[model samples]
Target: MIHGILNLPRNIWLIGLISLCNDSASEMLYPVIPLYLSSVLMAGPRALGIIEGIAEATASLLKLFSGVIMDRTRTAKPWIILGYSLAGFGRPLIALAGSWGWLLLIRFADRVGKGLRTSPRDALLASCAAPNQRGLAFGLHRAMDNAGAVIGPLLAFALLSREVPLAHIFLWAIVPALICLALSLKIRESAPAASAPKRVAFDWRLGDMPLVFKRYLVVVALFTLGNSSNMFLLLRAKEVGMPSEYVPLLWAAVSAVAMIFSIPLSALSDRVGRITVLVCGYTAYAIFYFGISATEKNTGALFLLFGLYGLFMGATEGVEKALVVDLVAEDRRGTAFGWFNLTTGLFLLPASVLFGFLYQGISPTCAFLFSGCCAIAAALLLIFFVANRRP
Candidate 1:
């Protein structure tokens, strides 16, 4: 198993390295963004909700457009390069925001880069590997991403502990972001066959996609309705008696857990079945959210629960992308991934806002319990409606 994964195609490793650099730059801000909003800008949960929802929705909508174009062009490297450049440029600008509104605009720009790159990059990875090896390929990518997530938070924690200005730390995210952009230029896309026909029309409908792919999109949309933003999870730690100082470290811890498990669990899905692994991952989300909903001021339990959530993330993230590849024709992968990201992000548009409302209007417990219910519903849908469709 180890030897096989270690020997994945060169493109996969290069792309994963790019992901690692970008994710490291992004995660550096993840641990600080909410805190900056709440503590520095005097924003509330509602504002945070609005920002996350709108930003994610914008990204999702663009992913669809970007993917469709990438497929039509039969070229991936340019989109990938532009996407990284935009994100690298946009990230540091967030440090200049004096209000949540400013933050939203800058953040939207950053997500634009994310939306632009994601589908094309995933498609590129799919193209680089064999059908049966996709799980390991995607897993390696996600593991690298999570490894960066680990690094980002630790760097943030270290800087904050040393009394660095928050703005300076935000500025620092640009370093890895720029590195990612530079490295992306190294990826080479082969020329299309001379006999290939030029695409004349844009395709927005999934009318010709497999029934399984379509149903799986519905399941993802349903599940995403409950999967609130990670900001809420961090906020929950603060609410449950964890000191503010440790939250970044906690973020690092969860990423560490995810990085450790992502490759193995995703590779496992290749043999056992994608649906089987997805069901378990969703089930873990249900359990974790319910546990979080019921727990009081117990930091210990939250850490344990967070660890479980990380394990669940490892089980699902790469495997889900691999499953999408499994469901579609090789030629249609970029568009399929776009639709997949679009469905989930579109639903998440509302889900994050609703969670914020529940957290503020009723109780945090109510919000989490609602998320748990959605997870359960999604898991059941996976079990009954979606086929495993292993390659």
Candidate 2:
């Protein structure tokens, strides 16, 4: 199995494996975190929103700068190594968080690591694959990462079923992270990137990028406003009658679907058109959120909706990124991905905060309906405004 995975060019599959292990460590704590904050630490949805919101927003702000630095250095491996190590080290520290306030700092630190790595890592992925097959490469990456997500939650479920404490589960996350760090030590930069002669000038201005890419960024920002934290979905699972003991498994199920579907669907985008898949994904989100709003009593329906949500993720996550790769120049790939991450991550603060408030104040149904409408609007705009250029 290891040989089969390693048979690919070392530059590509190695990062995918590293991401798999890293995500295994990170996600081991992901599903149970809301439970930890709500039950043990005595917090609310709004508090969880604040933690996720602040952590992501801070990471995004850092990403904008990190991309510029990465393009100047022309070496992704060192920054990638440091970023992965920081996040690996950060997750284990959550066991020591006495309050959500402390957890906020820890989450912020973890996401700082993500910020440091994401743009460079994405640029690396773009470099490794053929232009025509980028969707396949990125799809494979997302699949591996989602595979780890499946593993992590299943591990959490097994531990919790065996009556292990949540804090101990957090501590156990360190093991996979250590393995990930060891693997990352071997991630070499491709020869050209390692030996590049000139530095790419840093610029974040709109005029510096492609016209279509700029318009696409506008569409992306619009979509991100409605795409809030997954914490809400986990909370809704319990509200709809899924037992806390089964929540990890519920999370695992969704990830499993994404893992299964990511490769095939993303490859499909390489053929028909990325925009088609993206529109489909946004439409799926609208339906899933609408379904979630109505699924107050049926655990079965809630599980199905979460699975559909995962399908939406599988369809869009990699394909949309491959589209980004298609739209931007190779030299400025880091900046492109940086802006992509920024647009997605920056707006998430208000999205999550507003979702929390609406769920708490107006009603869960009202909040979900609002989000569904946003998804529909984004999909329509994507179809009409952003032209998919197949090359």
Per-prediction TM-score to the true structure, in the order listed: 0.97, 0.95
The CA lDDT of each predicted structure is: 0.88, 0.86
Scanning candidate 1 in windows of ten residues, the lowest lDDT window is: 196-205
Each prediction's RMSD over C-alphas, in Å, is 1.6, 2.3
Candidate 2 at residue 24, lDDT? 87
Cα lDDT tens digits, model 2, 1-391, are 2343244466778888998998888777999999899888899989988999999998888777777676676678877888888899889888899999999999999999999988888898888788777888888899999999999999999998998988888898778878978888888875564556466466657567888888888888888888899989888888778888899899999889999888888888989889999999999999999999988778788788889999998999999899999898788888888888888899999988999999998999998998999999999888888865333
Instruction: Please provide, for model 1 over 325-348, each residue's C-alpha lDDT reduced to its tens digit, 9 standing for 90 to 100.
Output: 989887688889899999988998
TM-score of 2: 0.95
Name the lDDT value of residue 130 in candidate 2.
Answer: 81
RMSD of 2: 2.3
